[model samples]
Target: MIKNEKIKATEVQLTGLNGEDLGIMSTRDALALAKQHKVDLICMSLMTSPPPCKLMGAGAAKQEKQQEKKKAAKTPDKRKVKEIRLNLQMEDHDRETKQSQAERILTKGDSVKLVIQVHGAKEGTAGKEWAEQLCKSLAEYGSKTTGIQVSGKQVVVQLDPIE
Candidate 1:
């Protein structure tokens, strides 16, 4: 926004500090009016034939911008991914513990990557069944985002939190 002496328009549509329209007048007159009110002559728009300007305290505008920045800084991104590893040989208690951890992360608005690693032969046929069962167990907290995929010795699937 052009302010005070920086404004080049010879005439402008002015508004007072109290928001009352002062109508169209010379830029010099508007500057003098702002000086009398101890405020800034800020050009609001340049689209009209004679640009529009308003009277406002510069310190107030600066404070508002600082407040907006602080408000933006307070919120953190929630799209982070948490990884949990499982295996076909996991015991009941171990599986339950991993499921609880995944549930905790999902409830906090983070996604989870489930990885079941198979060490021996028949990687595709052996690992997918266990992965499906695990996925069903976690259905209440999150939905599966990807189909069970088998690559070499690893079976991977992604789950996104329910919003």
Candidate 2:
């Protein structure tokens, strides 16, 4: 958007600040007309024959563009990966609560990760097996994205929704 004396074109199709066409004119005259309206002479299309130039406030044009960008960010994507944490010694009721929460998350077409952390010295096969059983019960909602895996003190399971 070269302006005024900075425009290399000898002549251009000129449009007034109020969007009225002033026809094709020399760059010098276009600058004079733009100055009369207290706006900048902007070269809009440099590639066209007799490039089109318009008289507009650069700040206003930039501000409008920024506002358009902001509007695009307001939309939301519902797909997400949610986590449900469990402990090796969690009570049965607490496990039921987490299962219900996972159901809700999957109902929204999202995925869930079930994590179980063993706290006591008995950080062995028992904790991982329990966590696997919980994950398997959720098969009514969807299939497991991965096989249950066990670390030294934690177990992780991933499930994706049917959709």
Which candidate achieves the best lDDT against the true structure? Answer: 1
Cα lDDT tens digits for candidate 1, 1-163 = 5789999999999988788999999999999999998999998778987998888999866775688889999988669988888887889899899989999999999999999888756766678887788789889989999999888888999999999
Q: What is the lDDT for 42 in model 1? A: 91
Residue 130 lDDT in model 1? Answer: 78
Per-prediction TM-score: 0.64, 0.51
Question: Distance from true position, residue 41, model 1, in Å?
Answer: 5.3
For candidate 1, the TM-score is 0.64
Q: Which stretches of candidate 1 lie over 4 Å from their true place?
A: 1-37, 41-55, 119-121
Error of 1 at 84 (Å): 0.7
